[model samples]
Target: MCALRTQFRYLNPYELHKIIINQYVLKQPEDIKLLQRNKSNDRTDYHVLVDHHRFLWEDNEPKTWEEQFAKRYFEKLFKEYCIADLSRYKENKVALRWRIEKEVVSGKGQFICGNKICNESENLRSWEVNFAYHEQGERKNALVKIRLCPSCSKKLNYHHKKREIKRLKKQSKYKKKKSDSKESGSEDETIVCDSSEPESSESRRIEADIPETSNETPWEEHKPEVIKSREEEMEDYLQDLLI
Candidate 1:
């Protein structure tokens, strides 16, 4: 492929971008030629030039195509050299899966709500926000604990669902636009937005029924009031005595 484009010294941004994108496919091994000769080191090197910035493969032999692709391929190569990030936004693929566990508070003495605005200690529960992220190509699991009162927990869950619905809708919209452009024979490579997987039926239902601008939730009207704990009353008595 590099030999075929001999007319140009190095591939233009679009040509190089396409090749990098195709490197994700594991089906075929990439055939790269070591052409450039380094006189000082007396070694032949493989070089790729983007916008006059040369990227040289220092090794004498090019590694397998899979090994060539880095975990931070988008940031390192695409964004740095090709200027793809200027016109096109790459979808962030972190924390797609989460494992949230909520447990009722037992034998607690006035636990402050983790919500910055809400300080209610009544009906407190411990919520663990567990998710995974890739740092330097290693997958790391993170667990964050937050103690929240019933009302705050409900509010958190409600807002989370709302945001999730919006995300699904935005992905669907982008996919529609991409497909439409493809059918019209004017495919826009810049619009590379798509969901990693299909959205569930429940997500579709929420997107259809829930209005993004609405501040109100369906269960808010019937939300149970948080009863004051005996520990709270005892603490209040102690404060009164201190006063």
Candidate 2:
């Protein structure tokens, strides 16, 4: 007998829930907005939907293109699926807003934790971390926010603190090493000076042992000797002959 094509038999809670929502949720058709007549052009302004829509939680401020898209997508998803109360899933109001913003900005379809290890799609919270980067040869600090599961969020905090401690320890070690090298260099210089002092003192003692002499001519070095002339020698010989 030929083997039957493989099929998925197991379903997780989320998958089951999604199936039930798809089958039971009441999806309503999109309602068309009334066309506004402009006297100048005698045409409808289609830009009203985009230009007039305001985002939630902001003082009725106009929404950006990303925000608008996100809002529409969220509403459509809710209409098609029986989504649980978003407040229960959101750790805070900020987290829900962040999730929505990320959806449209990043064009992501599912709301999942940013962590690769734990990509939980439910019960997410938003956190802001200080991210340092270099721009145009200058260091800059940016506040980067992301949604994460509770476990991943805890891990992120712990990792950040540990990294900070490690950086501080490395800085302190480098400073201590630099100070030690400087002290060693000074000691070497002092040792060299101390060694040279003995040689200088020895040279001074040798100079002191040597006797100093005043300026004198070379003939003065020998004692004076008596000299006899030829006539004096002849007279001495005559006296000897008379005797």
Candidate 3:
């Protein structure tokens, strides 16, 4: 019976069928239904959906994958994912709208929290994380937005409007301060010039009070000699009268 069992092992169609079937089953599903079911069970898994889009914020309804990613979902996730430090997740790389789709198909890339502390991971389908810049001609400001997982979103309790308003206010304040400092500096220079004018005039007066011997002429010294000669002639006439 042992020899017969060993001889039949290679011919066991059942074992061969089982192996073939398992491989076929694994290869059949384009989508991982198990993961989908798991994600659906927990709201936190929804963050993976954000990876489907890439935009920071949508001005209007998103029309293209690039537009959707750049403008709509990504910004929302960033607020949720933000954590303290934000530097440890050095392996995370920024994705372009085009690259995200390729990564999703390959089942490789996932969005990570830009914040180092959070280091949260999510599927590309759930959370859209985008790094964009707001630009109008030469003016530009960096915009970072992450579509947060449900758990992260709940944890953050973010206020988008408030943050935006605060950012704008800071910019305005900085501009005003810069303008004021420039004006004050210019005014100070003018005041210094005005103050120095009087000192310069006083210095000129002090210089003038010092007698200048260089201005004396040869004729001015001879006038003293002529006066002495006239005085001598008057004394001589007085002596003759006495004689």
Candidate 4:
């Protein structure tokens, strides 16, 4: 039995763009430009120039086979690049596989998501994953990549914004509370000083007016008591004679 051989025909530029737009959900024209610009080869200028030529092309403009061939060659390269890039998406495993199986299938590729402990099989549209080649050592290099589903991506962005808002609010509240506490503490100190100032002054005046020692001696204080006793006795004798 003979092994099955599939025909691999190259795609034209317009067909390639249509496929990208239809399958990958790339709606914006700018996104296509970005994708082309990010490719390993520097064909962004050529692609943009071709797009400009196509835009200005009217029925009067002569169509040449050479131009068509160049467009097809670039289109094939662009498609291949897109397929390889999109296959790196960790979330779009099914889509990536479909794209590879349908469009371009060279070999198996692996994809890991930015999320912790997330790994998935590569798909056709998975090339949309952002990737960078990191050189670990002289000869050792690794591809660092990140991928996300639309929902997960949106949720992550929203949480990041929410955290920023919460952080700002907390800082504002802390500053306001700190200022209020400082102001209140200063006012309390001022009130305490004002209330104690008059009392402290009166205490000092009383202390200053106090005599150091008494003028009378102990014997002089006792002599007054003896004189009073003798007068009392004479008064008693007179009263007895009158009776």
Q: Against the unseen true structure, what C-alpha lDDT does each candidate score?
A: 0.45, 0.48, 0.46, 0.41
> Residue-wise lDDT of candidate 2 within 141-236, one digit each (tens)?
544455566666565565343122111335588889999999998888533334554458878899999998868878786868768899998999
Residue 14 error, candidate 3, Å: 2.3
Query: Model 4: per-residue lDDT, tens digit, 122-238?
Result: 321221332223222223222222243333344334322212111133558889999999999888853344554455887889999997887878888567554457789899999
Candidate 2 accuracy as TM-score? 0.22
User: What is the alpha-carbon lDDT for the whole of candidate 3?
Assistant: 0.46
TM-scores, all models, native as reference: 0.19, 0.22, 0.19, 0.16
Worst ten in a row by lDDT for model 4: 159-168
Pairs in steric clash, model 4: 85-127, 86-126, 86-127, 86-128, 87-126, 87-127, 96-123, 96-124, 97-123
Looking at model 1, residue 191 earns an lDDT score of: 61
lDDT of 4 at 10: 62
- lDDT (Cα, tens digit) per residue for candidate 1, span 1-243: 677567345779897767756764443434332433557754222332121121222243425543344222322432111100111112322122211122123212125555544456786765554444554355666544455577655654542321221113355888898888788786434667677998899999988998668888899999999889999999999999999
- Lowest summed lDDT window (length 10), candidate 1: 80-89
Local accuracy of candidate 3 as per-residue lDDT tens digits, 39-144: 4446332444443432334356766655554454455332323222323224332332322333344322236533333445662123333343333333333343
Highest-scoring model, TM-score: 2
Cα deviation in Å at residue 92, candidate 2? Answer: 26
The list of candidate 1 runs beyond 4 A from truth reads 1-110, 133-139, 159-243
